[model samples]
Target chain A: GAGVSQSPRYKVAKRGQDVALRCDPISGHVSLFWYQQALGQGPEFLTYFQNEAQLDKSGLPSDRFFAERPEGSVSTLKIQRTQKEDSAVYLCASSSRDRGTNEQFFGPGTRLTVL
Target chain B: EDKVVQSPLSLVVHEGDTVTLNCSYEVTNFRSLLWYKQEKKAPTFLFMLTSSGIEKKSGRLSSILDKKELFSILNITATQTGDSAVYLCAAFKQGGSEKLVFGKGTKLTVNP
Candidate 1:
């Protein structure tokens, strides 16, 4: 695809169940980012990846939330134990440059609903 | 904590009307300010401003940043119904971990 793409546009999980979301950034993009957006609010930063290195995970809410970009092209976000509060749209973005003036291109987010 | 704030949580305008959206930030390591238009699942990039006072424009949409005042404004002139969406303002923080601190957003409704 010409732009970023995400799998499982919508996912529903029962409490305590685990779920994983996938993201495929634009080919050759050096930087990737993950965000969580709640209803009537803006996207909140969750983590950042510069190639295969997981540089920043400060914004991650809990230890249960984990993300990895093993090969630097595709990434996955895993939630170990789903909760109602974990319900939100997870967004993925990528920029060509690894640093400075990063104008990120976003993918259609995956909306997760925890029941 | 570093954060971005946007005003007028919601707005309604008719076709051919002009609207000005406001955003203010109090953040350290401010690399740049950005604007986005989100209608459904994804947010489309609109502008990214690093230097103060320079205007970035795309068709009817234009934006300007004032670093001194820690604020930015997005102006859309002669709006159309298709322009309706949630306009987001985000500040990209620099340094070891580059991340965007976003505001709650301003929802603009353009009715024809």
Candidate 2:
């Protein structure tokens, strides 16, 4: 794909139900990132991957929010036991370079609703 | 902890009017600042400022950074209804983290 691609544009999950969101970054991009954006709020960083390495998961709000990029290209963000507070738009981005002033390209994002 | 704050959470302006959005941040490692324009879905990259006093411009949008003050501003001149959207500001942390700390964002609505 020419840009980052996200699966399941919209998702509705019952409380305590688990959900998984997938992201396919641009071809050959070395860096991938996941962010969560609440209504009317900016996208908050959740995790970062350099190639297949999960380098940072500091911005994840809780232990239930887990992300992985197994093959260094496609990534998945899994939420265990969904809560109403977890409702938000999940964004994925990728950068061609691994370091030094690289510009990130973003995906359309997945809107998750927890009820 | 670290935070980024944007002023005038929402704004309404007539077409052809100019607008300026502000962003301030308090972070641990300040490497660069970025501006993005979001419409219905994804946010499109606008500008990235790494040094103080230099401005980045594209079409009718412009932005500048002030490393000393830990702030940045985005300006849109001769705005149109098509320009209405949410503007986001993000500060990049230094070192190898490569994470972006973002502000709440400014929603601009241009009435025709």
Candidate 3:
């Protein structure tokens, strides 16, 4: 079975540019999550989607970050006006059940560098 | 704010040695504690503990949770070079929605 997958393993963008990262969750996963990991630090929560509905966005650091999962299986995390501080790994995870029921399977992640 | 703290940010051990990693957390609506192993990329799930006093074991890796202490410990016995990786501890919270709060992670270096 295929695990969660993220596109553009690496991306470099100029400051102020907009970038979009894509994630393809496992075939039947009903829950998806996004997280940001800074250098030498742990991954911080970004947002979560249960199916096509955005359940939580509190973890998003700023208004510049946006995510959507219209179809419920694939998701996109878009960053507007990239900053050097945005340079890090964007991880996507999916789980068969909602939180408290099962563990999440993570994707390889897309490493973004803003210069 | 929710926080998960791991001890000994970094450790180095030789093969055949046993290593224990500690994780303590303080968060609202704590549901479960999880452990992950990261190797240069994404973290893979290791263990998820929801009840206290129960030990979860998988081969040479084992974990025990103490809900009263708000902590958990992961032990790797007879460590091998293959065990070298960053070990991450996370606390799952189920409030309005589900979220996994993480610690800075512990870098483990197992040299043969």
Candidate 4:
């Protein structure tokens, strides 16, 4: 079985520029989640989706961060204006059921750097 | 406020030795505690503990939760060099926007 996967393993963007990160969850997974991990730290929850519905977006740092999962399979996280503070690894995960119950399978995170 | 804390930020041990990692959490309305091993990218799940006094084991790795004390312990017996990585502990809240509260993690380095 293929695991969750993210694109553009590494990205570097100038400040004030916009960037988009992609994530492909496992097939048949009903739950998808995004997280941000800074260096020497653990991952912090960013958002969660159940199917095609955006269930939780509380962890999003600011209005610049937005995510969507229209078809219930692939998800994209967009930043309107990149900032140096946004430089971190963005991780995606998926589970067969609600994240409250099932274990999440992680993807190789996409490292984003804002210069 | 620190909701979860893992002690011994970094550890170094030789192969065939045993090691223990600790995690204590103060997550509101806690539901479960989970352990993950991270090397380079993705963090792989190791165990999920929802009940107290029940130990979960897989190969040389084992974990136990103490709900009453609000803590958990991950143990590795006869460790190998492959076991070297960052171990993360997370607390799942029963009902809240913050689903999983994670600790800073313990970086374990094993030498053969």
Tell me the docking grade of candidate 2.
medium
Which residues of candidate 4, in runs, are more than 4 Å off? B96-98
Where is model 2 chain A poorest over a 10-residue stretch in terms of lDDT?
A: A96-105
TM-score of 3: 0.98
> TM-score per candidate, in order?
0.98, 0.97, 0.98, 0.96
Clashes of each: 0, 0, 0, 0
lDDT of all the models against the reference?
0.95, 0.93, 0.94, 0.92
| Candidate 4 lDDT over residue span A58-100, tens digit each | 8999999999999999999999899999999999989887655
- lDDT for residue A54 in candidate 2, whole number 0-100: 95
lDDT of 2 by residue, B1-112 (tens): 8899998899999999999999999999788889989998899999999999998999999999998999899999999999999999998888877888889999999999
Docking quality level of the chain pair in candidate 1? high
As for candidate 2, its clashing pairs are none
| Candidate 2 TM-score to native | 0.97
* By DockQ: ranked, best first: 1, 3, 2, 4
lDDT of 3 by residue, A10-84 (tens): 999999999999999999899999999998999999999999999999989999999999999899999999999
Give the alpha carbon lDDT tens digit for every residue of A1-115 in model 2: 8889999999999999999999999999999999999998999999999999999899899999999998998999999999999999999999887875447889999999999
Predicted chain A of candidate 1: TM-score: 0.98
Off by over 4 Å in 2: none
lDDT of 1 by residue, A1-115 (tens): 7999998999999999999999999999989999999999999999999999999999999999999999999999999999999999999999998887468899999999999
